[model samples]
Structure formats: structure tokens, C-alpha cells
Target: MIREFDRWAYDNRLRAWRAEWKLIVAFVMLAVVMMGGWREQWLVLIGMAYWIVARARVPFSVYGKAMLAASVFLGLSLLTLVVSVSVPFQITFIDSQLQPAAKLAVRSLAAWSCLFFLLITTPAPDLIAVLRRMRLPAALVELCFLMYRFIFLLEQAAAELMLALRARSGGTHWRHGGMLMYQLWMKTWQSYEAFSRSLAARGGVASAGHTHQREKAHVPLVDVAAGIIMALLLGWAWRKG
Candidate 1:
């Protein structure tokens, strides 16, 4: 899970500065090359995968599992791009459609890999701190903070509820699943209401602001130079594409 990744990231030497630079540089190149050709996208994907597996030292199993989950959703969404329906509801693949779908799939995979690299190498708190330093909107940052905090809380609550249900039912069933889902929703809503009241009690939403000032991070000059090189490469790829 993400919590395990966070712990691993903090224990590793590549936690803050290197991870932040890689995150920014990788995504910038990804965005630029994503607008280019499939060749460029594939290049970006390979570079990112190498950095993640070799440089960042993320385990292949972790990367594979994450990509597999993403591919499932990406494949489903891409079905519309590749498949067309005829008058008789016959599904057909047009030759022209294949190119666009391939381009999209490559670009998407590159983007997802870049994102996963950042997620596995940087903890949420450090990432939020970086975002704050980058002058992101306070409200948006705060929303993300709350969402991150509550996701674990909600997951724990759901797990406990499911365990109780299983103890009573002896096994899972459609009816049990439905009951568990309903209870989870109700619990989530109640928790949100309580949080809202608590926030209200402490003046207003504006008072919920928490300053995230950490020790100044020192990004290596080499990384900055590399980022510049990547930008130039992306420009060339764009023109070539």
C-alpha cells in the first residue's frame, strides 16, 4: 500500500530533493512528449522506467502491480477510441483508429509511470510541502491534505466493518456486500459532518490553515542541468514529431 511506500521512501536516501527534482523533470518531459509522436512517448516511458527501477530502486513487483491496475482502466476507456459501432450494432476497428489509440496508450503509460515514480519515491507530506513551496492555492493544498488523511481513516473503518460482517455471516454474499457498502457510506457521511462541525467550531475554514515550512531542500545542480537538457530534448522531439 501507499503507506508502506511512504515508509520506504523516508528510509531511503532518495527521499526529498532528488525525488522532487525527478518528479518535476519527468512530468514536464512527459507533458511535452505526450503531444508528440509514439516514438517520443516510448522513449519517455523507457527513460522513466529506468530511473524508477534503477535509480530510485523501486521494486519491479510494485511497479508492475501499479501499472497493471492502471492498464485495466486505461484499456476500458480506450475501447471507445479503437472500436466503432455500425448501423446493426456491429463493432468494427478502423485502420485510422489504430494509430490514434496506440499513440494515446503510449502517452498515457508514460504519464502514469512518471506519476508512479514520484508517488513511490516521495511521501505525501513532503510532496505537499513541495507543492506549498511552489505557491499552489492554499485551499487546494488543504483539500488534498484532508483527503490524504481521511483516506486511511476510511479504509481502516471499512476494514473493521467488513471483518465484523464476515464474523457474523461466516462468508461474503451480495446482500452482505450491499449492507457493508451502505454502512460505510453512512459512516463516511457522519465523519464528514463531524469534521465540518469541528472546523466550524475553530472559527472557520480559513482557520484550518497549517503552515508547512520544512528545512530548505537543496536540489543538486546536476539535476537542474539535466532538467534543462530534458526540456531541450522534448522541444526537439516535438518538432520532429
Candidate 2:
């Protein structure tokens, strides 16, 4: 996925420019302002603006999914809060409780945006290289690789389970709900058992790669400048806040 984003970014000429540094600075300043108890609605506005400008140069599809996922989660969380509080707290729509929700949302958005930007833009292999360069243990890196591979397998298994359920249940109408759920549980268990058995047969250490060759790439000047500016902005935000 990271490789796909790299290809897309390069294809679209969405490489970093000098103005991106200014946007990063502005985001940091807004984050500080947000920490000073800005109105929830205002904070949300600023947070979104920060995300938009910060992600502007990246391939839209790469970052758009992150934004959409965050929005969905935020909406669901806000809805749950509103429903739970409507009686005791006398809250109405989302706007009535916007301040608290906005506070939570903005902080989450900031942290997620920071991490997502770093991950989507940075090559996965380069990340490993940097970690190795910093003397991280080989065992940990191997664990990371294994975990990444397993996650995709797990996701595929989950999709198959969902499809099987959908085929048998036909939208899980009330008449078939209980039976459908039972079938799903049985199928899920069988899937897990199969996966565990496969893992055990593989000596519980699948994909044991030998002779790892570390690929080398020259770090560009722009990447260095971007890192420095981001670090300074982060430091300033921390101290000023």
C-alpha cells in the first residue's frame, strides 16, 4: 500500500515543495491555538484545514481513505454520545455537545494525520532501513515483517467468512438470523483452526527469510529539510503550548 502511494505521488508530481513547510508550520500553530481552549467548532475547522493543506500534495486517493475513515468514526462516536446524553445531559443534536466532541476529534485528527502522513509518504523499505540504521534489533524487524504478512492473510479469511455468511443468510433477515449466526460462528472457528494448523506445520515461524540484503538509497536534500522543519514545528508547538 505504501509502495502504491509512492508510485501515485511520483506519477502525479506531488512531491514536496517549499510552501509545504509553511503549511506544516501553520498546522503546528493552529494545533497550539487549539490547545488553548478554542471553541470546539472552531477547533474542528482548523483541524480539518490543517489536514487538507498538509495532505494537499499527496495523491488524493492515498490520503482520502484516511480522511473518510476518520470522518465515519467521528460521526459514529458523536452519534453514540448524543444518544447516550440526550436525556440526562439535555443535549440535542451533535451541535449541542460540539465543544467536547470537537475537542476529542481535533486531538485525534491531529495525531492520526501526523502518523498517516509519515506512513503514506515514506517508503516501507526505507522505514526498515532507518530502523536498522538506528540499531534496532533484527528480531523486532522480523516480527514486523511476519505480522504484516499475516494481517493480509487474516483479512482474506475475514472476507471469505463474510461472503459465506452473506450467501447462506441472504441479508440475515430476522427469520434466519439465529441460524445464520450459528453457521458464521462455526465457519469462523473452522477457519481459525485451519490457520493455526498451517502455522504449526510451518514450524510456527513462517516466511523465515535468509540472507537479507539491505537496499541503499541516497536521502534527498528535500527529505532532510522536511524532517528538520517538522521537528522544529513539533518542538515549538510543545513548548509554546
Candidate 3:
């Protein structure tokens, strides 16, 4: 999933557009979501969905799967928020929690949709570049990069290990399944070590006595300018509200 996310990010139609505007559009809509009610949130949500699916030309399956992955957490959170009691075999939903939970669910989904659009369209390295251009702290930027790379690396390792197990026809065997976990742990450590070495060789981290160069992309004008303006207006209204 992480690899697919990175793949789409690098290969999406919006990949070449100026990362600045993408961030602007995403953050502005996020502002709208942060302050806007259900109506405003809905607008942002649907608009972002369309931009990602229709305008950006992302495959519907990819988008759905990505959102569905995020939805698992959101669902669990909403479940906990709505369910007041789980002990004594009394898993009861509290009536009083329904409205608040619904509101939270909407807000959370809106926020995730907005952010997901950004993630899908902009590659992680580009985002890190933008953060550096914004003059954010080196430590924070480097940490974010490492965390992002680490997730991708872990996913890659797990996928490879699972594939190996499956190829050997032991993927479903109980003994092999248990060993898979151990293999994955060892693979993760090895992948991390390899990643560290490669990153050091590339001088990926600025703190490692290496000068990290920043390559800026031209923020080309996009057709979404009008949409961005509209979103900013909505953000203004949200401020008043």
C-alpha cells in the first residue's frame, strides 16, 4: 500500500504542478475543514475527491483502497467514541454519543480526504523539499523524511517476505505462518540497516556533515486556481462563522 501510494504520488498527473500550489490548496481547504461546518466540509471533501479521482486522474480503486485503509482507524475511533460500555459483555452504544461521534467522523473524514489528496499528488521527497524551502528546522524535516522512508522500507520488507513465503507454498501453513513473523522482524532490521547506509551515501540527512541541496520545482499555473480561490472564500466565511 505504501509503495502504491508512492507510485501514484510520483506518477500522478498533478505530479509536475508546482508543489507550492498543491500545499496551498490542501492547507487552505484544511482550514476550511477546520472551521467549516458539515456543509463546508462536504464541499471540501467532494471537491478534493474529484480533484484526486477525476482531475488528477488517479484510479478509483487506488483512491478507495487508500481511503479505506485510513477509514479503519477512523471507524475504530468512532466505535470507541460511540460505545460507552464494553465491559461485562455489555457493548452498548450510548445515544448521547451519536451526534458528537457523527460530527467527529465527518470532520475526521474531511480532514483525511484533504490531506490524502496532497499525499497522493506530491511525492514525499518533494514535500520535504518544500518544507526545507519554507525554512523549517533541519531536525524536523530530516525526521519527517526518515519516518516516511522508514514506513516505505518496512512495507517493502514485509511484502517481500510474504511473497517469499507464498512462493514456497508455506504461506498458509501454521508453522510457516509463525516463522513468517520472525522472518519479517529480521528482514525489517536488515532493510533498515541497508536504508541507513544508502541514505548516508546519498547524504540524505543534512546533519551528517553533508550539505543537502534543495532543488526547487517551478509552480506552474494550474486550472485549479479558481477552485483554490473559492476554497479560500469558504475559509474566510468559516473565520466569520
| Local distance difference test values of all predictions, in order | 0.73, 0.55, 0.79
TM-scores for all predictions: 0.79, 0.54, 0.79
For 64-122, candidate 1 gives per-residue lDDT tens digits of 87888889999999889888989997989878888888778878888888777677767
In candidate 2, how many clashes are counted?
Answer: 0
What shift in Å separates residue 132 of candidate 3 from its native position after superposition? Answer: 1.8
- Which parts of model 2 have CA positions greater than 4 angstroms off? 1-58, 79-97, 122-146, 162-188, 198-207, 210-213, 229-241
Off by over 4 Å in 1: 16-20, 84-96, 202-240
Candidate 3 lDDT over 21-40, as tens digits, reads 78988998888788778878
Model 1: lDDT of residue 117 = 69
- Per-residue error (Å), model 3, residue 223: 2.2
Cα distance off (Å), candidate 1, residue 226: 7.7
RMSD of 1: 3.5
Task: Write the candidate numbers in order of decreasing lDDT.
Answer: 3, 1, 2
Clashing residue pairs, backbone N/CA/C < 3 A, model 2: none
The number of clashing residue pairs in each candidate reads 0, 0, 1
**Which structure among the candidates has the greatest lDDT?**
3
Q: Candidate 3: global Cα-lDDT?
A: 0.79
